[model samples]
Target: MSDKPKTPLLDKVSYPADLKGLSREELKQVADELRTEVIDAVSVTGGHLGAGLGVIELTVALHAVFDTPEDRLIWDVGHQAYPHKVLTGRRDRIRTLRQKNGLSGFTRRVESEYDPFGAAHSSTSISAGLGMAVGAQLSGKKRNVVAVIGDGAITAGMAYEAMNNAGAMDARLIVVLNDNDMSIAAPTGAMRAHLAKLVSGPTYRGLRHTAKQIAKALPPIFHEPARRAEEFTRGFFTGGTLFEELGFYYVGPIDGHNLDHLIPVLENVRDAEEGPILVHAITKKGKGYGPAEAAADKYHGVNKFNVITGAQAKAPSNAPSYTSVFAQSLITEAREDERIVAVTAAMPSGTGLDKFAEHFPTRTFDVGIAEQHAVTFAAGLACEGLKPFVAIYSTFLQRAYDQVVHDVALQGLPVRFAIDRAGHVGADGPTHAGNYDSAYLGAIPGMVLMAAGDEAELKHMVATAAAYDQGPIAFRYPRGDGLGVEMPERGLVLPIGKGRILREGSTVAILSYGTRLGEVLAAAERLAAFGLNPTIADARFMKPLDEVLIRRLAAEHEVLLTVEEGSIGGFSSHVATYLAANGLLDSGHLRFRPMMIGDRYAEQGSVDGMYGEDHLDRNGIVATVLRALGNEAEAMRILNAGRD
Candidate 1:
């Protein structure tokens, strides 16, 4: 904490209102100090650094030019809003970002009134801002609504759909296209800045408005030609023809990082009485920081690091990560099978496809930020007899649920889904958690869902998915390391709808669906201290569950517990439905308890901390067993032992 940067100017700014009277030069100093503070904060508590750095000037400009608490400002993924958070009265909690009981990694309405809409996922800003703009119009409350979306986010169909509707209605909304990475077009210089200011200024807008009125008064044929002429003239100079066609007045390609260039144009756009406007600002992903600027993706999300050397802190672990294991396993399958190909929705690295791409470059496809399109594209590949592995994060896969249903599951396409981050994603918080995928995917008909109990099991699952060509099959794995169990030389293809028992017992049975098998085993070891020897079984498949094993376990054990790292309606729900349908519940001899993520969203913490808090960890499992065995006192003791 003592090593934190000194932000003298930023210290004076308590809120966006503090930026109101500051001159352009003073605002520039504030921006510089703000960037340092953000860098220092993220150096301690790692999170999205590059995007936030890119929008430092723009965030300052928006807050300074418009009233944020009243005038709504919606950030498209909220990854770029860290600077906005610092300027909007959350400066004190800046270091606690993404920590337990601390500030969220993204925007949350409950966290601050300045944050009107919450988002961790991308490309919903335009739609949300339009809704807010229409709501303000209906309430007779005049407020400037701005949706700052990145170029990558703008590629999604939802952004266009929202833009089309906003244009059609002529709603008063500002869509600031933060073109940081995707080179839309260069030509950014003094001339570009001047033109941006000129168009956004009152003189040009007034002249254009007068010309529109005159054009309306002319004969129909003449008016149509005159409008086309004016549009063409501007389109030739500025590459805004596409945005203009979508019913928005386009301005800029202006330098976004420059406070001088950004502030005035934002001020002009703020004062202008325009309905739907698009301001194209050219910024760098990691504007000020040298390391971040050099490599964009590395700094996009980071671990705590040494600020001076730009070296990140690496948590030492014995086992390889699930992502890496998945990548290697998929590569093993693809090596033998020429038809095996991979698809990723923007997350080539995060989903482990980048490694797969290294081995099979042409076979891997990175569909930029469009999960819906990626799913359908994979379906098309599957239709042609080629095996398409759509590797996507669990939270992101939810976006393409319809495509997963219609194009793949309903059609019974053999699309192998390698779902990473299948459980709570630690500090990234609830929005990024892979809690609902199990529930969502399990509900689809003809869908086969499997979870890995260990890295070895993940290998087997990958082989199984590759060998099976019956229907759509998915395998879920967590974000962290494997159990350090023995690694297989090559993956083995296991039978479908089958599970294996890890340990044997008599009175109690613990059926695990995912990586929580490690915890279940740990719980069994601890349960021995309480004179309770629980049977541990790894139910790899949630869908097409091993009914024979379930019936036998239910018959043999007095008490049964189902554990998973997913939401309520997932593995546990399926298990309960089977037991209920088979009259396992009618006979009062057996007691069944399903442990899952609670009905509410758990707060962000370490993966272990979050799981322990939700009572799904080893200690939690031990507590549950004792309680189920009528040892309530011992259960409470075990529960409180590790709890903070």
Candidate 2:
């Protein structure tokens, strides 16, 4: 028998509506139970822990105060929505969080009515909530729209843009700034400093009394003047003048963990009929869990762990992770070159720029949650004749596409892009997947695109990018550890637009891009048992395709198969286009097959599981090869045997 926490109060309530009947004191008890439930669930599921734990009191208060489903509550980034999920009638499946076909790690509108807007990316909740509020106003509905955004998320330019628009239109939107003092990485920039001043300053406590006095003393005609005076006074004291200028009624710096303070304040805000309001609630990232609180990152994301010891279980691996390799490689390159600099957008640790920062702190720039700004800033540095390496995750690079096109690529700036998490990132699911970067970047003219086959290749590419000064160049690598290839003391810059043949054979040719080369090799080994020795080649550069090698392979081999970790319109598409344009595919002799990620959103699971589901694994690759060679029966047999 399994041991579960005793939650008599939590047992009574399944949804937010059930909390309406409970007393304030009972609700406080319910909050405690909710916290325990969240810890227990996450302990097993191994997901975002500290963010959800910090928001337990806030989550309970919001649900108890607001009529949810009717009142739209959007959580920015959704890392902190685990507690929200537990309360929104998803407790039964909480253990299955981030598993395939199970509850998503983040908020999804399709999952429940309570999640009115889906969110995985940050700084989008306020905009979404404001839209909902405006739509309600247009339809003659009086429903409340509350957007709970974290301090980290608010640092993004998108959050401020939404705030500006909401304030200008005087939209009836409630934006809860969950000031936990941290995002995935520790918060940075001037905005963080301003928020810190607001929380610690006595001005926050004095504003309410002064505002009330001004409102009471002023007559009907003097109301506008009195309000402005109040705004200036509050702004002068607490540094909330900026928020007021943006058109939001600034209302907080209160203790988010205290239900005594939280309930009444939320109730007041819920009843207010004013312009967009910004409630800045100060809370800890990890409030209750001692282990989480003591940790530097507050256990932002965690693996499955022992409940008592709080020691997370990580799978043992001898190979170094791609992130660590990239960091080390960059460090090696930076040591020799004085002009080399590193840039990241609020993800120094995640993108492995922390190591670079340790060596060259002055040279590293962490523009907080601003991808667009990061790209343009790097471009600006490049304009001054500096080699700027913009290290960012693939999904995040999508946010700065315009900057890449106009500021970097079009201008022909020699900015190096070290795109991490370049393919399917497991557990984070579709939202964090880097499935589109290849297609997006490949479409742009004068862009040099490369995918690393292994850690050694990645090092070479890093060296290649550092040396290349012609135009924008981007190289991608996957999430986990690289294949345990032999290491080089220093990386060698290979010739541009060239590929290397790994194994030479007769009947078929398997052309692979990125980390999928390992799987292709494994499939080739399996094919050898059937007396079919297929040729395997690694196309290191996707853009400026290796025409000579590809054409030679086409002429020699009966079938040419292309595989990549990216979606359609990526490396394979480029290869096919080149083949078609050159009259290679038009020749009746050559058979062509391109394998990529299927056209659909993949759910959260292990990386290998996602590849298997998409039929891009070793077994799938073997089957694809067999079927293409007019052996359908053999292909089906191989697939079925692997399943069995």
Best candidate (score: lDDT): 1
Candidate 2 deviant stretches above 4 angstroms: 182-227, 236-239, 296-298
Instruction: Summarize candidate 1's per-residue lDDT along 66-171 as a digit string, tens digits.
Output: 9878899999889899999999999999999999999999999999999999988999999999999999899888889999999389888899999989988757
lDDT of 2 by residue, 19-57 (tens): 999998999999999999988888898988988988999
Residue 344 deviation, candidate 2, in Å?
A: 0.9
The alpha-carbon root-mean-square deviation between model 1 and the true structure, to one decimal in Å, is 1.2
- What C-alpha lDDT, on a 0 to 100 scale, does residue 334 get in candidate 2? 95
Q: Looking at model 1, report the run of 10 residues with the lowest lDDT sum.
A: 180-189
C-alpha lDDT score of every prediction, in listed order: 0.92, 0.89
The deviation in Å at residue 565 for candidate 1 is: 0.8
- Give the clashing pairs for model 1: none
**TM-score for all models, in order of appearance:** 0.98, 0.94
